[model samples]
Target: MRSLSLLLFTFLCTCVPAQTIAQTVDTLMEYTAPSATITAYGNEPGIGTAAPVALLQQEELTRYDKSSLLSGLNRVPGVRFEERATASYRIAIRGASLRAPFGVRNTQVYWNGIPFGEPGGDVPLSFLDAVNTDRVQIIKGPSGGFYGPGTAGTLLMNTESIHQEGLFKLAPRYANASITTGSYGFLRADATIQRTKEAGTYNQFRIGYQRTDGYRDHSGMDRLTLQYTSTFRGQKSGAKTALHALYTKLDYELPGGLNPEQYADNPRQARPGSADKNASIHYHNLLLGLTDERSLGSWKLESALYTTGFYFDHPFNFDYKREANLGAGGRFALRRLLRDDLALALGVESRLQYRNGQNFTNPDGTRPGDLNFSDEIFSRQGLAFGQLTYTPGAWDFHLGLSSSQLDYSVDRTFSAEGVTGETEFTANRPVSVRLAAGRTFDFGYLYLSRTDGFSPPTLDEFRTNEGGLNVDLDPEIGTNYEVGFSTSVAGKFFPSISVFHFALDEAITSFSDDRGTQLFRNAGKTRQQGIELAASWRAISTTDKAIGLSFYTSYTYYNFTYLELERGGTDFSGQDIPGAVPHTLNVEVGIDLRNGLRLDLFHNYTDAIPLNDANDVFADSFHLLRAKLSYPFKSFNVFVAGANLLDQRMSFGNDLNPQFGRRYFQPAPGRNWQVGMSWTAAPKR
Candidate 1:
């Protein structure tokens, strides 16, 4: 705590009196969208938004090493990204990891305006290559009134360039390629090519491959990705259309968590019996999407359709599983100006999926011995939403409403006893509502909002890997209230502050049974509140001389606790929320010199985290330091990066509420280094 305070004070003292610069550089790093093209609301500027939102452009994204988004996303006040192993990712937005045993849930995700993720609420982020992403927009707090049924907010990712329309600013044709190598036997290569025709047609293609030996035993990963995006404006129809396609083949080894003793002895070793089982995952995925926008007289229409197909082959210490899935979804919306100062919009979205899975006993961890169970599952979810936005003078008002429903059925074809009939679980229809008001001032924007939402159980929580089915689990319902303000001081210092309180009923959390099966159950109630502060400063800027210095810092404070909870005859009321760290801070400094040379230094400090609902175990706090340097020539750039400069021993993703004090630690790599070079070819302006 003392060190954290000292660092914060030093950073503030160094940034306060810096000379102001032009708005161009500051806008690129952090700024409100000047238009609604990249957001969900109507066509308006940031003053019209009444909720907290974070936008990261390409320049801000490349400040990291480009290996993973963990460090980059941590810059966001209330967002947390964790990795249990190589390519095994999890995300929590303004919430704890109680329900997210693996993957992302509770939050809604979109790619290029098309709905992404499985119908069952699991987002496979591992399939995405961060290098291809051009921008990311995060809407904080509950946003089901516009995005569907979710309590943890929304994430919109744009892989295509923002300069795809209007006059062409870049060369008609361009190509870029890069390769990187790092410690722990990490290797990566990727290339991209783009072409634009005089007839208003643009196309881009990208391919990437990555492999790593990993830091722990039996933890290795390999992946191949291919993506294509095309956009064009109709010559006579006066309409625009975009097509997107993505494919990935991923393979990763899973080194099971370590117990306290094993961690103290050798944190690099695999869990007991994991070697005999050869635990790993193999996945193949393909996704296709299309988006179209056109004018219907005085109204505007936008629609999106997408399909996804994937196969999963996984082996664990207890069982081996094979699964296949196919899903499709689409969204349609229409917007119009009822009056000069008022606008209305309506949309509908639906998704359906079918999955077939078979589990087998793994005697040697490498091969299946006998089939334990075979089952099939079908899931469907849909939502209808409408919103009204009124902007009159300096006051902005927004109201949104939505109705959502979810249902799923499971049929067991074969089990230990015999064939079983189908079992169904249908959730009650829920209505979500949001109301917001904002006031814009010459110095800044101030806003407040209220949101009510519900999140249904995901397929992974309903059916465990051990073939156990749970139908009694209920959806989590919650209400959130937030207020925030952001401002810029002389185009040199940008700062923002947000405060929120969320109350939830029937909170969903996970637990492990004695047989190693992870399951979900509804806890009683919870009260969560937090404060977020973020600031960015351009300490010195001299574009003419090509010398610049900048600093960014974010701080988060969580005061979350259980209101009412009882499990297994033990009272757990009033305990701090497990997996919810009380405090987190991130600081980054960038230095730019002459001749396109740059350096970035980062520091991250995380408070101790409770590892169980009972509050009997906790993971100690730790500090992480990283640095990167780059130098550019005419057509190519070379860079070097290092992580964990202090060589701190730390656990990144810890398993919460393990059964009978079992393995709960996932240690991160001690130290690593990376070197890479990139080349680009383009026509002169």
Candidate 2:
């Protein structure tokens, strides 16, 4: 690790000194947009509505980890992460990660208006490099009514727009190159170039590489990515079009979880069979999309086309599997303003997926011993929805209906070399309506809403232990009621609070069968209620703006329980839901010094969580403290950051449902540090 860091430093030092560009000074304000105004008042009017949302920009996240998503997104309220190892992350928005054993579920993700998550509702986050995104908008709510069937929330990420840098009067092009190195054998390099023509055309491209010899045995990771974005004015006035391409190649070693005693004895040890089994994952993913929006008189139109594909090879202790997937989807919406106070929107979308995969037996955990199962799966989804929004003076009202259907079919071609072909088909149709009303105050806004959401099982969730299909599982449905209010004081303090209650019918939970094969079942009904609050106050500052200080905090409290449930005729009523995140608190302080130097301190705390439906096993609570320092000179910059400065010995992520050995802990690095340098050619100050 030390050698790699030294080499990276030498290379960056030799390159950055000669390339610095001129720039300006900067600081942050508490609030900019005081009222609820649709970002789409100009385009894509129906895609995202006004709600309790969070926006983070490059300026705020520039110093964080360039390869990890949790670094920046964790600052937002009601967001948390679990990591099985380096480059592996599971994120939950508003405690929506109930049954997601891996990756992000119950959330939708978009890149430049293109739905990458689509109807499958699984976010490809590990494939995304944090530095590639210049802006992120997090919409926290039941997203089924607007962004497909995601019951938790939605994320929109986009590259920087050159026009926003004062392109009209100044330079129309800029480029930057950066190098970063850190503890645990980390090394990264990235280059971004952008150009904008005077005729309203935009183009940007980025390429990055990351490698790390992780803290634990058999946990190394490496990734490479390339992304390009283009935007231009359409032939019609008030119309714009955008095209985006993002490609990633990633591979990571998987060190399975550790038991409690094993964790305490040797925190840096890998799972028992991890090294011998050579467990790991290698994958390639690509996203291509085009988005167009236009305005014709009082009506606005939005449309998008996207195609995504991935191929992966996963080798574990018991199975060697390979899979390939290809999917295509598009969305269309037409919204019109009624008179001056009312607006109506209608939309429809379709998505199709074709997949081919196979599982092979692994006795020695090296090569394929024999064909265990081979299958082909396909799914088709259709959605149609409409919404009516009315603003009568200070009051805002919205009502919407969302209806969707999916058809899934599977064909098993081979199993154990002796099994005959088997086939199964499933069709699911789910519907829901959403209603909301809010009033604007001089300080902020007050809102209340009732919504319904639906989520269907994914292909992996539908596969049976015998490698055929689980034809009995049903879609999980939820009904939500929430009230929220937000306010800002003197442009220095901002506060928001919300309370919510919900009942999830046919809640889908998971358990292992007698043969130790994982399975999914509709466990029964669950009830959840929660309160969340986020506030920020300028603890200290100066009139000259040379030095400033601010403090921000977010807190959440929730009670999620199984209201009614039965397993093997044993009534497990009123049991705490497994993996339910009950309490979380985050506090941050920002300090800025003159001459473009800054310091930030962050502290996060989470309560212990139940790890099983039986509620006896638990993952212990943990606290983390992190810090970052940065200084900018001209267009050249340097940053240093450290994580887990307190050296907390605990799991960063854990398995909610595990085998009998209590192997749930995925230990985090004790203390890690990173240093980076960058040089840029940017618009004139």
TM-scores, each model vs. reference: 0.93, 0.91
lDDT per residue (tens digit) for residues 248-318 in model 2: 88889988778789988988999887878778888899989899888867878899999989997877767
Worst 10 residues of 2 by lDDT: 25-34
* Candidate 2 all-Cα RMSD: 3.9
RMSD, one per candidate, in order:
8.3, 3.9
Look at candidate 2 and give me any clashing residue pairs. Answer: none
Tell me the number of clashing residue pairs for each predicted model.
1, 0
After TM-score superposition, the amount by which residue 419's alpha carbon in candidate 1 deviates from its true location, in angstroms, is 5.1
Off by over 4 Å in 2: 1-50, 60-63, 165-168, 363-367, 420-422, 425-430, 464-468, 512-518, 540-545, 683-685
Model 1: runs farther than 4 Å from truth?
1-38, 162-170, 544-546, 683-685
Q: lDDT of candidate 2 vs native?
A: 0.74
